[model samples]
Target: MSQPEPGAVVDLLGVLAYAELTAFDRLAEDARLAPTLTGRAALARMAAAEIAHHVRLTDRLVELGADPAAAMAPFTSALDTFHESTRPSTWLEGLVKAYVGDGLAADFYREIAAFLPEPDRLLVLEVLDDTGHADFAVREVRAAIVADRRLAGRLALWGRRLVGEAISRSQAVIAEHDGLADLIITGTGDLAGVGRLIERITSAHTERMTTLGLNP
Candidate 1:
């Protein structure tokens, strides 16, 4: 917290702003794959939540004297690559992606936010709030698996792939953005702190998978 704050806070907010906007778009597109009207509507609600978060972050960036669009621009390419590479081929896969991918990102960002000064840290946590969709995703996916037990194995594998892609993209982001890496390392107080943060994220993911009756 002793180091300069504006650049890191702005960068973090920018990344989050774009992430939320893209999440809204992705969830809306994925909704088309939903098997039922109720399921589609649920995804639609989650998409709305993402947009709300995006607006909050964008406004915060402006209040901090940053252009929302310009701040989000640097992360646009990398995040797009991440979504493109991890695009879901099936409705079930999309649910698993939404649940697992979003959870992982939230966990990681929350951990880093702990290192920020009071203002940015609080704003980041608030924006990263759960959309109350985890339970819905777990219930829907579990019901589908129960109806077709064979789907369990496929979805478990899909969850693992999402985790893998998330990790790869995160590593690339860190390598390409020294400020982001510094923000995380400094927030954690050291590299060991970063390791523990990642461990926490993985543990949380395992719990979510188990809740869904999927292998971690």
Candidate 2:
């Protein structure tokens, strides 16, 4: 595969930077839904990391001489649509959304980071959510499922919907942003590679759901 043009990387950097900012905002808002003080604090810490990522990415964008807001603008509509459509109805559902939804996104970013050039690639890899957040989500979600077996179906169904909406928006991004698509393909080789990436993400998500005692 040919190397992506410098312009494409710039576009990707913008997208990534904006994505981190918005993710931080959403996670911070969702943190309010946590049931306990410890859970809330855990989510707050995760949100703080996201904010730090946003700051780093934004600084990188400035270093690249790109307009950070403009770079993020193109993604705003579809991302807004996804969040609006998938708002959690309960505290447990919120935890599920944070864990399952964001976990999948983190995996996607990690896969895509492999294709980026240095500094940018390293930044992407470094910004991923830590295991502490994942462990907290898993513990909370599993406890909920165990306490009430009936929630398994509902949470599973919600998880599937979150994944579906995520994929839909992802396709929208790929379709509308040739630069991002080029970056991904250039890094991963071809359509098959992207499919494998998605498969790996889905497999991880399945394990997460199973760990929570929910059928995937």
Top-TM-score structure, candidate number? 1
lDDT of 2 by residue, 89-149 (tens): 7878878887888888888878877777788878888877463667777888888878888
Candidate 1 on 132-203: residue-level lDDT in tens? Answer: 779898898899898999999999998998899889988987798788888887777887888888889999
Q: State which candidate has the highest lDDT.
A: 1
Candidate 1 local Cα displacement, residue 100, angstroms: 0.4
The Cα error of candidate 2 at residue 156, in Å, is 0.6
RMSD of each: 1.1, 1.7
Weakest 10 consecutive residues, lDDT, candidate 1? 1-10
lDDT of each: 0.89, 0.80
Candidate 1 is scored at a TM of 0.96
Supply the global lDDT for candidate 1.
Answer: 0.89
